[model samples]
Target chain A: MSDVYAARRGLLRDRCAAAGNAAALITRPANVRYLTGASPLGAVLLVGPSEDALFCAGAPTGEADEGRLDEHLRVTVLAGRGGDPAVAAADAASSVRADSLAVEEHHLTVARHRALRSVAPKVRLADLGTAVEQQRLVKDEGEIACLRIAAEIADQALGELLESILVGRTERHLALELERRLVDHGADGPAFPTSVGTGPHSGRSRHRPSDRRVEEGDFLSVCLGANYRGYRCEIGRTFVIGTTPADWQIELYDCVFTAQRAGREALLPGAAYREVDHAARSVLDSAGHAEALAPWTGHGVGLEIDEDPQLAPTAMGKLDACVPVTVEPGVHLPGRGGVRIDDTLVVRPEADGGPELLTITTKELLAL
Target chain B: MSDVYAARRGLLRDRCAAAGNAAALITRPANVRYLTGASPLGAVLLVGPSEDALFCAGAPTGEADEGRLDEHLRVTVLAGRGGDPAVAAADAASSVRADSLAVEEHHLTVARHRALRSVAPKVRLADLGTAVEQQRLVKDEGEIACLRIAAEIADQALGELLESILVGRTERHLALELERRLVDHGADGPAFPTSVGTGPHSGRSRHRPSDRRVEEGDFLSVCLGANYRGYRCEIGRTFVIGTTPADWQIELYDCVFTAQRAGREALLPGAAYREVDHAARSVLDSAGHAEALAPWTGHGVGLEIDEDPQLAPTAMGKLDACVPVTVEPGVHLPGRGGVRIDDTLVVRPEADGGPELLTITTKELLAL
Candidate 1:
């Protein structure tokens, strides 16, 4: 495991050296955790030049990145409180006599960047851009296993919720129950807020759970995910609240389910991101619901709930094998509610089996 | 209610004008919410030489900050997707013939700042610094009311957990249960991640709950807060697991309780922020436990959990009337765990009662 972290750091070092930077400072938490196996609060990873060093404001919590840290990386914990880790990392970079240092300009504030420049005036500063994020776009088998277990936890939670009485319960209560079940099934926490939108609120992406009660014959769309270890996976399902579904509800559900299936089927290695988005979006676009569609059809999900390779019309890039992404598509009629079906799938080559679905829950519209 | 938001924006405009900035763009979410009473995703507030406008990447969710928007502010929702709201606001500022504009440099990234400058080259960009944060230091009556309710909800949640069976439960389960109870008591959600540490893990600041279970004669520390409306309040307490607390546990709890009370008692209008921190910190410092202490003894809590007017040793500021802050003090002995006591209180004049304690949970150490 330590060797894995060392290998990741080696890859980052090669990229930095190629970009004419002797040292790279990773301040973003996810990036820091990627290069080093752990990320303590205000911890920064300084790689290459001489030796890799993890500069931190204080001692590691032992819970976050404890024993998993790479043995090859030097750990520097500051003695005082409220000191800037980025500044400390820059000073460390200066100590190593690095001529140039690369930093994540997208994540660093202008103030922090200026401070870093002021502290280490001799070292030229360059932007590392989204190099680390691009590196994290695809999942290793170990990371995929974490996502797979996360998806399974979410599936079990949602499955148990379906078995219990849900009618007349407020959206907030149902959401809370789902979250509790997620933990009961061994999730570190919810990937994001467990969105339980019912009635007119159904099918909306990122709906805040309200006190609205679940009613018979109303659409109930739930979007939830689980965080296991550090990886995150998302799953969403829509169902009718009563024993019999209304005609419009069934129609909307079928349309969304079909579009979602198309999107999932389009998740092939080397497929253009926009092409995958169009596969699902064209279905809804032809049905006259294009104006109300969300910005993105789906997005890559891994350590962070939302990552790279956005499945949008304007998105650039091609899907690679082992990249995990979510395929969520929905149509919401204003004041009438709608349906959304989502799944977390990993892109795999056709010979290896196309798009191994991590979220195995049945998407067929269920009436309960 | 709309007038309240307008008034806040007017105050900010006056400050900007005094600073020689004819236009100001507020991109920080809390600042945006404070000025316009709405913080739509990717929304930026431009307070300017002309009528103020809010530039949003998409339509408002109409859930959060929905009914509270100031009617006086013009809202410009971008028709298309994937446009930066800050750039749009800067362009709007340029259109209004503003010679100079101020932005929250502490919040904006270097890349984002560069993009804003490129789009609006005519306008000179100035750092807004902490002007908006300073304006939010003292709470109005309405904000105080929200904080009061948030505290009550947290107190209720903690009270209910005390009545349940807690022994042998994993720290994660306890934390999740407390979160559920917060929602049950009508909190929007937990203000921060609920912290539950058992035995050796107890009393550590910001300890991530682990799989540790409670045992006889162990110390258990729990810290949690509630978000009511948008206002947040926090409370923390520690208890003994068995019928009797060992001598050291009892002595440690008493000392922490006394320190917390001293800090609470020191919360008054015109009190130096560090003085309040010293009142509590001195207790632990005198006992030779200074090395294990956290950076800040306490901090202000409001729209965001940790706000300005931080109660720390090196902090510079005077507490004003209507300022809501927390005074949390603890001491953790390695391998033995320890005690922590915390509360949210509002500073008031001596004539009207020194400080109003919002978190009214009893401070006495309880043995379960």
Candidate 2:
């Protein structure tokens, strides 16, 4: 586990050197968390020629990361009241005689960039630019172990939810209940806000839970995940809320289930990202519901719920083994609701049992 | 309200023109919501020499706005499936033969900036900087009206929580209940994650809720806010768990209440931001609790929960009339726990009352 984070920093350091940078400043929270295994509020990672340091606004007071930090990492707690830590880091880098400090221009605000310039006038600020993100696209076995536990936690939470009498509960209450269940199952927190869309609200992407109650014969779409030890995974399932599903509801559910299966089956190494999205999107597209689709059929997930190697139409990447991504696609009728089936799966070569399905929640339309 | 949004845009346009730019692009969410009446996720507003246009990722999908587009504004809904709307806006400005465009470099990511450059190579890019944030420092009357409602909703939520059984309820459940009550009282959402700390967790700044439950003879500190029409306001109170507070609990509560009141009273039309913070800090400092104090006692609230004119010792700004802020001062004694009292108020002249209190939640420590 310690080797995973240290190796990530080592790779980043090599990329920084290749770009003619003696050191790199990381301000993105996800990247910071990835390299140092410790992400305090407003923390930055300074990977230099001499040593690697984690500079935080203040020390984190949470138990989300029990074993993420190791002795190899130097944790520098910034004073509670001080100027920007990035500026302080720039001055430190300059004083250490590190030439050409590369920074994540995408993450740093222009004002913060200007402050860094003022603090270390002699240090050159170069663009690091998505180097660490590319490094994080694939997961190591230890990271995958964390993701496995995260998925198990999500499964337990969702399984408990399935056993409950869900009728007459509002989407908001159900979402809150699922979140509490996530924490009860020992997750640091819900990876993202739980999405519980019911009745006319089902199948919408990232639907904000509302007061609309679960009704008889209504479509209930529930999507949630858990974050365990800095690793996160997702699972979504659409259910029928009555003894017998309506014909339209059953048909829509089957279509989405089939589409999600197609996307899952197409997850081999070297498969074009768009090909996976296309395989699933065409299932819904051929059925004349193309206008109701989301922009991406699926996306990579890791430290951040949504990461790189997006499975969209113009996404410029190939699927690699060990990269975990969610193949979620759905179609929603404007007024009558719709169905969406999703699962988080790690891309694996056919020789290694195809893709490793992390989120094993059943896609079968359940009736309660 | 329409006129207020229009006038806000006009002010920004004037500033851009003064800086020798005829067109400006605002990509920051809060700034976009402040300038335009709507923020439809991933949207950007383009202020031009002729007419203002809001380029959105998608059309409004809710009854929140109900097609009441301002007559003075032209709204362009992008039909594309994937891409940054800022690039579309820069292309539009280029198509219209605009020579140069000012962008919110402070908000725009370097990748997004590069996309803007690639889309419109003929156009020159300039940093609009924090002009919108500057305009947002002193909110308009309409914004104040929304903040007043937000505060009222928060107060109602907290008041209702006091009437319920508190003992044995987990911090997560209590936080969720407060959020549900906020929505029930007409809040669009919680201003931020509702903080409900108990026992040892009580009075801690930025404490994320946990599985800890309320117990007898424990201190219960809860901080929450409501978001109504994008305007946010905060209120926090520390209460005792037993039928009667201990002598130490009473002393701590009185000290926090005094500090909060002093900070609120110092919010005059011409008071320095640091002075308001000192008025609060001095009370706590004299009580021998300076070591446990937070960096800032209070901060302005509007489209964003933490806005300009921060009430901190190092903050450099004077309070202006119409500036709404929250004076929140707390002390956390490691093993003993402590107290915090917070309230949102708007700075005003003496003739109209020095600071108009928005949150009417009682400051008295209640035992439940």
Candidate 3:
């Protein structure tokens, strides 16, 4: 594990060296965590020829942080409160005689960038672009294991809820309960807020839970995921209340399940991201639900729930092996209910058995 | 209600006019919420002499927003999926006859500020400096009413939690349960991530909850707040987990309670912010706990959990009537648990009762 972080630093150093830079500064929290294993609040990672340093806001001590996760790195804790770690990292970069440095401009706000330039006026600042994120787009076996555990945690939480009565429960309470269960199942927390939309509110993307109670014959749509060891995965499913699902409910559920499966099966090592999106999107498009679709059908997931390799109509890039992505497709009628079924899977080569499914929550139309 | 948002906009317009700026752009979320009565996802308000416009990312709807918010103000929903409302407002400002436009430099990121300049090349951009925040420093009666309700909800949640068994539960569960109770009691949500620290983790300000379970004779400290209709307030209290506290626990708890009370009592209309901090600091300093103190003793809370009129030792500015602020001073021993007491109170004239306590949770030491 110690060698992993150090090897990543070496890789980044080589990349920056190739670009005519002596150092690379990482400001994005997740990227910092990936490179240094530890991210105290507002921390930054500066890698130069002579040194690799982690500059944090304050000391990182808590059961949550797992200190020294960066076994090969030394952390310099800032003394003053309200201090920017990026500026501190820049000063460290100059102290080590770093003449030119690469910084993540997309993550650093303009103000922080200017502050860094003034802190080390002699050093030439360059954009590192999404180099770290691009590296993160492809995962190792260890990263995939973490995502598998995250998906399993989400499945366990959702499975438990299916055993209990949900009628008359407000969406907010249900969502909160799901979150507590995620922790109970040993999750860092929900990958995102547990979205529980019921009845007429069903099938909406990222619908914030409301106080509305679940009634009989309503579509109870739940989208939830868990973060296990910093890796995230998502799973969404729609269930029918009462003993039997209505004809419309079954039809909608089957449609979404098919679309989601199409997107999942479309995942390959060399397919265009847009082609995968179209594979799922065409299913709904033929059913005359094209206008109601979200901008994207699936997206890559890793340290962040939403990351690179976006499976959108306009997305540019090819799918790569080991990239975990969510394939969620749904449609909602204005006043009637709607349906959504989603899954997390990793793209793989055909010889390796196509995409590896991470979230194994049953997508069958279950009537509760 | 419709007139209120319009009237707030009018007040801001008058302030900008007095400063010789023909228009002002408000980008901070809370400031926009205070002036517009409706907060979209990353929306900005541009107040012109003749026209007031609210620009947002997505197409917005709601009769109440049009009627109860600002009817006379034109609301423009951007046409694209991705567009910065601030830049759009700046372009609108330049095309219009406004000679000068002031923007919230602190809130606008360095990149956005430069982008705004590039979009509206002819517009003279000036620093709005913390003008809207200064106006928000002295909140209106309606704002106070919402904050009062928020405090009540938070108090209710904390009170109920204290009545439950706490010896075996983990800090994370306790924090999550308190949040659930807050929403149950009518809070939009917890103002911030609820803090629950046990034993050695106790008494630290802004401590994140962990999986540590409460034990016998442990000092349990908790800090939480509620958001009601966008208004927010905070309350914190520390209690022992056994039948009787240890000698050190009692001493620390009493000192913190005394300091919190003194700070609360100092909340008079004409009092200086530092004086309030001193009232709390002097008690702890005399007890030899000065080095362990947090940077800020307390701060104002309204649309934001932490706002203007910060009660730090070196802070400038004086208190004004109707300004609600928290007086939270704490001390922690590295290996031993500590205590923290906090409260929200409105600074008022002596004639109307010098200070009005909003968070009415009892300061009594409860052994749970």
Candidate models: Cα lDDT each: 0.89, 0.87, 0.86
Pairs clashing in candidate 1? none
Ranking by lDDT: 1, 2, 3
Q: Give the poorly placed runs of model 3, Cα more than 4 Å off.
A: A63-65, A79-82, A94-97, B15-27, B44-49, B52-70, B73-103, B110-126
State the lDDT of candidate 1 residue by residue for B1-368, as single tens digits.
88988888889899999989999999999899888777887899999864789888776775333577766888888734777989999998888789999999889998999999999999999999989999999999999999999999999999999998888999999999999999989999999999999999999887889888988888989999999888899999999988988898888888888889899999989999999999999999998889888878899888899998889999998999999999999888877888888899999999997899999998888898
| DockQ, 0 to 1 scale, candidate 3 | 0.34
Q: In what order do the candidates fall by TM-score, top score first?
A: 1, 2, 3
Model 2 lDDT at residue B196: 89
Interface RMSD of each: 1.9, 2.6, 3.7
The number of residue pairs in model 1 that clash at the backbone is: 0
Candidate 3 on B234-338: residue-level lDDT in tens? 999998998988888888888999998889888898899999999999999999997788768999999999999889888888999999999999888888978
Worst 10 residues of 3 chain B by lDDT: B59-68
For candidate 2, give the lDDT of residue B45.
86
DockQ of candidates 1 onward, in order?
0.64, 0.42, 0.34
Total clashes in model 2, counting residue pairs 3 or more apart in sequence or in different chains: 0
What is the DockQ score of candidate 1, to 2 decimals? 0.64
Q: How do the residues A55-74 of candidate 2 rate in per-residue lDDT, one tens digit apiece?
A: 76754555423456766777
